[model samples]
Target: MAPWLIAAILTQGALALGLLWYLGTIRIPMVMRGEVRIDDIALERKGWPKREWQASNAFDNQFQLPVLFYVGAGLALYFGPTSLEVALAWLFVVTRYAHAFVHITDNHVIRRFAAYFAGLLLLCLFWLDLAVRLVLSL
Candidate 1:
């Protein structure tokens, strides 16, 4: 496996940790204090804690955009990794981390979207490279 592949997997784990920490900080106290019932936070119409919701949303965002990343990285492993591909992979992961950071912090939309768009551009580069490789191989 490429070093970038390993880094990508570790990045996913890091994102998971962020989600766990944020949500746990909120839910654990509620449970321990018995301030709310299961249905209160679970099924009821009550809104979630803002930061916790942001964390959860960020976590969901991971699965969506990063699926392309996983595929691109896996293909790169099979095709043999290029330095450019590896660099772009790292860029995507770094931007995603930034996006999550912005989300859980002040969540300035412009900053978050900037990071998100940068990742998308990186993803597109990965795809474009794959396409070129495919055409060249034929």
Candidate 2:
């Protein structure tokens, strides 16, 4: 795996952590208080939807997939990475962050689809890489 790939992973991982930190410390309470903030950073001005403890569950749904992807990517770097694999691994993180942003802040069509498809593609690539490597080694 390339060093730049590691850097990409680290950058996305940091952003994900930042998102979690903000959510736990900020969004959770706001949700508990039935608050939704305007998403001015987004192309649209609509606020996040009303959420309760369901917000926490939503966080879990959002966070869980990427964490697994991160672990898989880390192992690939530690073991080996085809250039294509590294690229896809990096894409996974970028899309995960985008997905999270779409999921939590701005629920728009393009952003939501970009997040979902990117993640699904990466996950497929991750599994394919692992499967082929295992088969070839055998």
Give per-model TM-scores. 0.87, 0.66
Query: Poorest 10 consecutive residues of model 1 by lDDT?
Result: 44-53
Model 1 TM-score, all chains together: 0.87
| Least well predicted 10-residue stretch by lDDT in candidate 2 | 49-58
Query: Candidate 2 residues 70-112, lDDT tens each?
Result: 6777767766767877788778777877776666664576977
Which pairs, if any, clash in model 1? none
lDDT, residue 52, model 1? 61
**For residues 1-138, could you state the per-residue lDDT of candidate 1 as single tens digits?**
488676775786688677777767876786677765666777742645566677777777888888888888888888888888888888888898999889878889999999999999989998899889878989
Error of 1 at 12 (Å): 3.4
- Candidate 1: which stretches are off by over 4 Å? 44-46
State the TM-score for model 2: 0.66
